[model samples]
Target: MVKIKISSLSFNYDSIQALKNVSVEFREGEMVGIIGPNGAGKTTLLKCIAKLLKPHKGVIYLNGRELWSISNKELAKILAHSLFEVPKGFNLTVLDFLLTSRYPYSKGLWETEEDLAVVEEALTMVNAKHLVERKMEELSDGELQRIIMAKLIAHQAKILLVDEPTVHLDLKYQLEVLSILRRISKTKNILTVMTMHDLRLASIFSDKLVLLHEGKIIAIGKPQDVLTEENIAKTYGVKVKILKHPKAGLIVIPLSTL
Candidate 1:
């Protein structure tokens, strides 16, 4: 059930190393959160996985096939990437925007009934069915995030790579989006990987956390193991109070700097 296996992955921006010899594996139906401070290679890792960035060293295997070896058309059928910001100046309607995800499997210039059905289902999954007729330019940030997620769902990719999915959302929508992602991961058996700065939300929603520091993985495990006080202090230079919430389970409270 291992969906992605990255070994000794390394990437650089000219002389500056963005990701160093990092190795990780993600499995089906698992929602993984990648967390780190600025300049920690979190975004780099996601880009590598999405095949948007070619690593200078190391290899990435998606479902046992070398990621770089897969053609872009074929890769698009199995992998999807969502960015933190919505695209600008697009005049497409919400439904039309979502239908674009089907292009990998599409033929001619028309969408079949099946494609339309999948888009509708995806919209419902993100609780944005009411926004179907709305223009993408008119939707709020939170609403647009949901629509983007719906497009990913509609793509029906077995693996989803998202960067800072909750970045622009308010607290409520942040949780709502994560909840939708968690449900999609389970229901569709998609391997969901997201970069998040909100440690508490990551801890609560993720089945596993990958903590990166200075381009290397400091820890990878369940939230309790990866978000330890010692790890936080060392990786983030912060002192934190870890408390248990009666309803929400573990809560991370940043107390002060190291």
Candidate 2:
């Protein structure tokens, strides 16, 4: 079944259109990556799916129901978002922060043993069990990113929307984060959608790639099918070569300017 169906979607900020006629469907347990250069509608499309920004036209459905009809509480059950920044005054430890994800179903701002068990499982998923007691501020960029992801795991949302999850992470952490997401999609049957700038990385880990440019979807399909030289050149205004890497399998090299 389709976990998310975005049809004829269009969005605008005043007269400036951010997205135009974008349509796509995400199935359960699929890892779909959105990639494009800066100023492209990658983030806009993600925000639209997360229901953080409403589209001016078209519709978004979650499990065949209108997204708008789903209450916030209900939405929380099916969808969870991981933004780039940590909220201020969040002085909680890694464990404490991760447990907050279960708040939607818990009571009195406290987590029960079941909640703790869930949090522990999330930590183990990211191999973050050792850092559970560390302060959020004390961890490195990569460690903190994993902790946040662990929170989403604890939330247990079927659909996950992440925005530039590896923006501040190092190369190793970048791969680790994406690898974790891919594993989650397979093992947990969660539909994962993320906006990524690392084209090669996205192509390698994602089952499907959606390329957006100039407020529209330029291409969408398997990474091998969608990340073509022609499509890359047209969308980014730069010529690129698509090659099979010896190790990574898919590699994108920007050859020249258009």
Candidate 3:
């Protein structure tokens, strides 16, 4: 079934248009990745779906009902999201951070045993149970990434809207984080939609790809269909050679002078 449906969406930042007539639908259990160049409205698209930014003209439906009809608390239960870090001042532990996810269900009261159990499972799911008491600020980049992911799992939402899950991580952590997300989506049967700047990584891990250009969806399909030479060249303004990798199946190589 279609869990998200966006139709005729448009958004602007004052005079700057961000999204234009964009429409897409996400079915249940889909692991989708959004890819685009710097100003392709990729982040805006995610924000719109996450209800952070309201479009001037469009309809966003969640499970067939208009998205705006759902209250924030209810939406929090249905959709769990995480973006690149913003300003921070919290001193929550890894477990504390993860347990916060249960607030939508518990309303800031003392957590029940069920909440603690879910938090424990979430910690183990991300392989961070050992760091349950670790201070969030003391973690390495990769460790912090996993902690955030564990927190999301604690949320227990069926749909995850994540932005740049591998931001500011080294190559090893990048692969590690993406691999964990891939595994979680499969094992938990949740639909995940994340935005990534690395098209190669996105193509490798994503079950579906949404290619955006100039605030519109230029292509949307399987990685093989959306990551074509022609489409990449037009959307990214780069000369790319698309070939089947001996091991990676499909890979893109840029052949342009910087």
Q: Model 2 scores what on Cα lDDT?
A: 0.87
TM-score between model 3 and native: 0.93
How should the candidates be ordered by TM-score, best one leading? 1, 2, 3
TM-score of 1: 0.95
Clashing pairs in 1: none
Off by over 4 Å in 1: 84-90
Candidate 2 clash total? Answer: 0
Candidate 1 lDDT, 1-258, residue by residue in tens:
548999999999999999999999999999999999999999999999988899999999988999999999999888999964446687768877788899998988899999999998998888899999998888998998899899889998999998898998999999899998998899889899999999988889899999999999999999989989999999999999998776685788889999
Ranking by lDDT: 1, 2, 3
Query: Which candidate would rank higher by TM-score, 1 or 2?
Result: 1
State the weakest 10-residue window (summed lDDT) of model 2: 83-92
**CA shift at 3, candidate 2, in angstroms?**
1.8
lDDT of each: 0.91, 0.87, 0.86
lDDT of 1: 0.91
TM-score of every candidate? 0.95, 0.94, 0.93
As for lDDT, the candidate ahead, 1 or 2, is 1
Runs of candidate 3 with Cα error greater than 4 angstroms are 84-90
